[model samples]
Target: MRLVVARCEVTYTGRLSAYLPEAVRLLVFKADGSVLVHADSGGYKPLNWMTPPTVIEDGDGVIVVRKRAGRSEDRLEIRIGELLAEVEHELGEDSGLEKDGVERHLQEALAEQPDALEDGLRLVRREWPTEIGPVDLMCRDADDGWVAVEIKRVATIEAVEQLSRYLEVLRRDPTLEACRGVLAAASVKPQARTLCEARGLGCAEVDLGLLRGAREPELTLFEA
Candidate 1:
């Protein structure tokens, strides 16, 4: 990861036009050739970002970031006003993401009892393969419609985005045109819930203890 902080003006030109006036902001250059420009606020989402398969050219005092989509091209140019700081770190190879406790345990329990996520939901298979990656679970609803399940420890916007991608691919198949998506997690952030609802996806909060074979009455007794 390379972090650069500088006072710069950014201009984006492509399908749309955007401009970030001169200011002190953070620029992140990832090992994947992705670049992100971030303001001090706006939570975690960057002000502007260019995904991988991009090229970055750093001149004396200016930087040009460009990406090509299909036959069209998009470009982001950053004109440096002042150089603040720059640092790079050689983070070793990632061993791969480790699922959280809730994610692992909930997925296992849900696989054993698909109805735990939705009534009449029957498991077709776990880790259903796709070009991108394997879905957590693929199932059939009461109507036999395909349901793509993505289990997360804590549902966030990224989780919803991932499920959306899976649904896009699955729905492309004529046999699964009626396929839908469900995001099951221990808890869901408001933003995530809103995005899922807007995308016509279903959201369910799984009961960790119940899925683990704990009696509900015992939970109530413990709560009391």
Candidate 2:
């Protein structure tokens, strides 16, 4: 990872146009050719980012990040004013973060009882592979339609977006052209729910306890 603190202005042009006036910010260049511009605020989310499969060129004093997608392209032009600090680090061999506890347990339980997602839903396979990555669970709906299920401990906007991407790829398959997507989580935020509805994706609140074989308390009534 390479981190640079510099005074720069950024402009992005693609489906939309955005400009960041000259200011001091952090520019992060990852090993995968991804670039991120971060303001002092906004927590972890970068102010702007260009993902991998991109090319970054340093020409004279300016930096250009370009990505080509067939005939179209997206570009981020950064005009550097002054470089405050620059540092590079070599972090070798990351095993990646492991998912544990609820999210992991939930996925396992759901895989065993796919119908818990929807009536008559049968598990076609778990971790169904795709070009992007493996989907959490792939199932067949009542009508035998393909359904891609993404399980999250807490369903947020990010989770919805992730499921949307999977749907995009899954639908490209002729056999699964009509594939549907479902976002299942223990709790879903309102914003996430809205996004799911807007995308015509299904959202289900999973019962973690129930799926883990926890039964409700039995009620005993005395004669009255």
Candidate 3:
């Protein structure tokens, strides 16, 4: 990650135009290919920012970040007026949040009663193998089609991406060529839901209370 405190001007052009005239601000260029411009007073929010999967072009006193937004492009241009302070840090690979007691218990419950996530879901295996990592559960649906499941207490965009990666690897086999993915979690975040919907991945939020025989489980399975 690179951090710079500078007097700079920022302009964003995409669906909307935003301009920040010359001012002293904090600039962050993350290793994940994201860029952010922050003003001292905005608390945590950046004055301008761009998410990952971006193209960055840096030149003398100027940096531009570009991302594809449908047919057009979203761009952020930073023109440095004066460089105040600069620093770069090598942050190691992130150790992501773990599945706690609740998540583990949720997995055990779902594994025991796979139908609680989707009507036709039948457990085939747990810790299904792949090159990248293990899938939480592998199952067969009503039609006996393979379904790869990733269990999380709170599913995020990362979870959706993880399931996507698993599906990419699982679909290589002729027998599992049609294998799909489902993210079963206690809670699914909205952003993750949107990504899953766009990618044609399944997102199911299981109510532990309802799944534990508190009430008859009515699962809504996404058909891919």
Candidate 4:
């Protein structure tokens, strides 16, 4: 069996919801500015824009499609109501199409989501551990103390509580060399931050702005 990996970056200009009542369009260009295929609106339109077949240059503001067969194509087309469908799908049948009190980001996109926690761990690699449970992240610093991180989008009290539990478990582990626990998130509650300090656990606050475009989060160590 052969597995094909699609390498494409999504640069969203408008809304990323499937519930939005508008059509979404994408422009695909070949390496030489040639148009190969335009698939959108449940149909495929071939060569409607490009006059000649050419190589599309890298970073040309167009979606470039490459296949293992050495064939490539590009298109300028709309995804029709795919975005709206996706949004609706995220809500599911039980949660109707109400947008007033619904979450803007998908549940999987939230910090509590496993993927988000893993992503945060990638940013804090120096502290990664070989074996750990389903916690977001586990790492060791120069001091050889364990740093267990839990990421949250909204940085609520519950997130801190969850991290606190993970820390408690780590503290009891005889194999874990470090005795300190760290809780990190996009934001942190005052009480949660206070509790961490009172409990002698390390605390780190991550800025979403820094995580967006910055290379990584800067760590400043202080004696706890």
* Highest TM-score against the true fold, candidate: 2
TM-score of each: 0.68, 0.79, 0.57, 0.36
- lDDT rank, highest first? 1, 2, 3, 4
lDDT by residue (15-89, candidate 1, tens digit) is 899999999999999887779999999898899988656889999889999987556888999999998999999
Residue-wise C-alpha lDDT for candidate 4, range 1-224, written one tens digit per residue:
11112222232222221121232333344233334322255465531333233333333333332222113233322222222221111222343233221122222233333224333232234224322224555554455545666555555655666566566455556776354565666566888888878877666655544434435666899999
Q: Which run of 10 residues does model 4 get worst, by summed lDDT?
A: 83-92
Better of 1 and 4 by lDDT: 1
The reply for model 2, stretches above 4 Å from the true place, is 69-71, 128-134, 140-146, 164-180, 216-224
What's the number of clashes in each of the models? 0, 0, 0, 19
Q: Residue 63, candidate 1: how far off, in angstroms?
A: 2.8
Question: Residue 1 in model 1: shift from native, Å?
Answer: 2.0
Across 1-224, the per-residue lDDT of candidate 2 in tens digits comes to: 99999999999998678999999999999886779999999898898888656899988769999987446888999999999999999888665446668899989999999898899999989889875567999999999998999999999998998898688677766898899999999999999999999999999998878877797645799998
Instruction: Specify the highest-lDDT model's number.
Output: 1
Q: Give the Å shift of residue 11 in candidate 1.
A: 2.0
